[model samples]
Target: MEVTLLLEATENAFRIMEKARAHALGVLDTAVQFTGEQTRFMEEKRWQVLFAGAQRRKTRFQNFVGTALILFAFWMLLSGHFDPFHLTLGAICCIITAYLFHDLLFANVRVGDMRVVALRFLCYIPWLIQQIVLSNLHVASVVLRRKMPINPQIITFKTKLETDISSITLANSITLTPGTITMDIRDGVYYVHALDQKVADDLNAGEMEDRVAHIFMEADHLYVEDVLDAARIYDALRV
Candidate 1:
């Protein structure tokens, strides 16, 4: 009976040991799984941090270069190579070139490509001239006509635009155009006072929006959406 009791005790101890081993193995497995997940998460975060740092450095470099160019241009201007008229022309040309050719210098940020900007300029210059001339003629016709038929109305509308320079350029263009004037602009909504219904409807229809985007070359590189969206304020009184 003692031998039988001893064998039973031995069997119980072995079963207990087996259960303890299983529990230890389960804990170890869970620990290893947790470590692996942490390692992967840490690696991903490190990669993101590295990428962002690189981008910030690149942007700093671009800003340095842009500033240097502006200073150099001013230096040349002061050196007297270009006279007053020539200086004015040169300055305007410099600004246009900088705006249009930024990608040639600053290669990152995926701002709209320089090639697109160039193409747009090709289209935009002639279009601008045509617009200016046509508007001038329209205003002249109205002024010279026997009856001064004028019906000025203020129209407000929202634009789905997300760039600063482009929108401001658009506002200036609208104000510059004869008979039509921009009365107020807040956010992406513009309050334009048009000489007639035709120009008001045209602005609402997105012709002007598309043109502005095209001129800016849709470069997503700059903080264009924020700058462009917020900087536009034009108020021109139509005569």
Candidate 2:
């Protein structure tokens, strides 16, 4: 009887120890899983924060470089000095100005490839020149007429352009044309002085505004030419 009681007690103790070990292992596994999830969450958040900061830094750098290049070009154009000493001084001034006012130049700039914008603008120049020539001839004809046909009037229209650069470009283009001058721009509305009723009708046609929007990639509606231009830009970038 004593031997049997001792055997039973030993078996029960062994079973209890086996159950306790399994419970401890279960608790440890749950704790490990929770810790792993927490670590992953923190890592993801850290990566997101780092990526946002990097993007901000990149945009700032781009703005600075763009500003510097424009200022340098303007300096060269206005100074008309090609000597090394003058070039160096101009470059230094441009760099300083860019550093001080980079944000101002790009403050309302849309997010797009500057190269694409430049290429489009270059393409637009020929068309603009043609328009200017046509306008000049028309103006000359009107001025040389016996009646003079001079009915000057101001016309106001709200523009769909989203960025300041596009708006300014459109304004300048109008002023460059012989029959029209951009009097003022306020709250996205342009006030233009037209030399005659024909000029006013042409301004109301909205072709110039559309072209400006296309150059800046700010158009809500894209023409076939605009689509082709965008496709070409994309392919070039991919290469």
Candidate 3:
């Protein structure tokens, strides 16, 4: 009887030890799975961060290159010197200027098609030149008048232009004309000194503002002519 009881007790002890061992192995496996999932999550987050940083760097590089090229082209156009020494000097100056002020040129670059903007700007130059000539003649006529009807007056108008660059361009264009000067720009309002009432009326007509807005792709209202011009520009580019 005593030997039977001892055998029963030994069997019970062995069963308990086996169950404990199985439970420990199951817990270990669960821990290993959780650790692997955490590692993968961290790796994915790291890759995402790296990719975003790379994209930002790429955009900045493109902007810098574009700015440098534009500066160089403008320098060449203005200097009109094709000699190697002058070319090299101008290139250096443009590179330096672009490095210093690239952000200013591209600050309000909202449109993806920079080529379109450039073409539009080039087209605008001729129109601006024509306006300047017409303005000169008008000013000349005013000066040659027997009474010299020089009625200089300050006119203020709120501009619809969106960007700082566009505003500056408008201001400079006004100053470049014979009878108007951009006196101050305060809170989107332009204070201009016009040599006569006719000059003020011409500015109030908003043709110049509309053209500037079209060039920058920031027009609030598009005209039929603007749409046709844009279509023609796109067709020319495709060819």
| Best candidate (score: TM-score) | 2
Query: Which digits, one per residue and each the tens of the lDDT, describe model 2 over residues 80-132?
Result: 88999999999899889989997897887666677789998999999999999
TM-scores for the candidates? 0.58, 0.65, 0.63
Best by lDDT: 2
> How do the residues 1-239 of candidate 3 rate in per-residue lDDT, one tens digit apiece?
53345445554655575576557556755665767866656755665676577556655665667687778878989999899999999979988987898777777667556778889899999989998998889888988989998889999988867778888888888887769999999999999999988888888766677678778877534433564564455335435
Which stretch of 10 consecutive residues in model 1 shows the poorest summed lDDT?
230-239
Q: Which runs in model 2 stand beyond 4 Å of their true positions? A: 1-33, 36-47, 69-94, 226-239
Instruction: State the C-alpha lDDT per candidate.
Output: 0.64, 0.78, 0.76
With a 3 Å backbone cut-off (N, CA, C), the pairs that clash in candidate 3 are none
Candidate numbers sorted by TM-score from highest down: 2, 3, 1
Clashes in model 2: which pairs? Answer: none
On a 0 to 100 scale, what is the lDDT of residue 130 in model 2?
94
Count clashing pairs, candidate 2: 0
Q: How many Å off is the CA of 22 in candidate 3? A: 41
Span of 10 residues, lowest total lDDT, candidate 3? 230-239
Each prediction's number of clashing residue pairs: 10, 0, 0
Question: What shift in Å separates residue 20 of candidate 2 from its native position after superposition?
Answer: 43
